[model samples]
Target: MQQKIIILDFGSQTTQLIGRRVRELDTFCEIMPYNKFPKDDPSVIGVILSGSPYSVHDKEAFKVDLSQFVGRIPVLGICYGAQFISYANGGKVEAADSREYGRANLEHFDAENPLFNGFVENSQVWMSHGDTITAIPEDYKCIASTANVKFAAYASTKQPVWAVQFHPEVFHSLQGTQLLKNFVVDICGSRQDWSADSFVETTVAELKAQLGDDKVILGLSGGVDSSVAAVLLNKAIGSNLTCIFVDHGMLRKNEFR
Candidate 1:
């Protein structure tokens, strides 16, 4: 089975970027809804908790049982993910005195930890959270900090849990990719064997097994998703695939063409 990372999306604008960075590390990763957890699947090597637009302190904020992923596999949380893990783990996540946005410098980080293996002293990082992790559990310790934000980063001493208040997926953070590399490659022990060929091979095999000898019909839309699906289905079943382009007759001029 191919090893992969799972990123739980909490509706952050940069969720896709996080997946992109992971793939760029030559590792396969899938993003699922925040509340969804792939139960007992061995293909998963690590789990990432993504940031959210809503604060962890919000009455209607997104919630998930951190216990679902923490001890089971290596976990990395970013922005809202960091805050949520802290808040859920009996830590204190309070509304910040002010929104800590934009560039911040990590004045101190634990060099002994594998997560910060390649980090430079006073490294730059992007921060965009409305809440701060004021306190954490006794088993968890601060791993990194900015002059302004004391608890900019943290990790659990007992489990495979790590989190950062900064936005490492953004381009502004120069060493952001390195941090992700450290997490996905080092901490997660994921092999850099994911490739386009492997993806096509596995997906086509699954499609063939699921759709054997059965005809498939797909709506022909010129959009990215539909187009890609059409190609994949065509590859899987060949002549058994039928495409019906539904022109609702309400398209703008030249749209049907």
Candidate 2:
């Protein structure tokens, strides 16, 4: 079984970006829908809860039972993930006086905390949410804080669970990648064994097995993404792979086409 980090997507636009950022760390990860958690998978080493557009108090908010992950596996929550877990438990998450968004600097933080392992004094983080955590349960301790947001980051004293209001996966966060690295590499203790080379080698083998004597046509957008995908598919099944490209046509295409 291949070890991987499981990211529970709560319909956040930046959720895939988080997956990309984690993979950049040479660690394999999967983005599962919010409610569809892989409870019995021992291959999962960590879990990341992605942000969402809906509030925790919404009439139609998506939710999951955190009990399945909390003490069993390392957990990292971002934005709505942070709020929902807090609100669902005994903590208090309230509507911010104003929707806080964009760049913010950490005014106070515990430099000794595992998550803030290489963080400098003025670490900048990207925030995008209308709600904020006012208080956390007694078992959790504040690890990082911004001038406006007191609960910028928190961690469980008894377990490896942690939560942050910022989006470290975004580009604006200066040390955001470092934070992710700390959580993934330091806290979660991932071997850092997965990489693009390994991904290609493993994927090609899997594709070959799954598509035995089968023809496949993958859509291409003339972008590096699909182009590389075409290469991988071609490697997997030889001439059995075919692709369709867009016309009118962005040579530097966006995947959303």
Q: Pick the candidate with the highest TM-score.
A: 1
Those runs of model 2 whose alpha carbons end farther than 4 Å from true positions after fitting are 216-230, 241-257
Give the alpha carbon lDDT tens digit for every residue of 1-257 in model 2: 67799999999999999999999988899999998889999999999999999999898999899999888989999999988777777899899999999999999999988899888997989999999999998789998899999999998888888899999999999999999999998988888889888889998999899999899988877767788989999999998887877553554435445
Each model's C-alpha lDDT? 0.90, 0.90
Candidate 1 lDDT by residue in tens digits, 147-189: 9888899999999899999999999888999999999999999
* Model 1 worst lDDT run, 10 consecutive residues: 246-255
Clashing pairs in 1: none
lDDT of 1 at 143: 92
List CA RMSD, all candidates: 2.1, 3.2
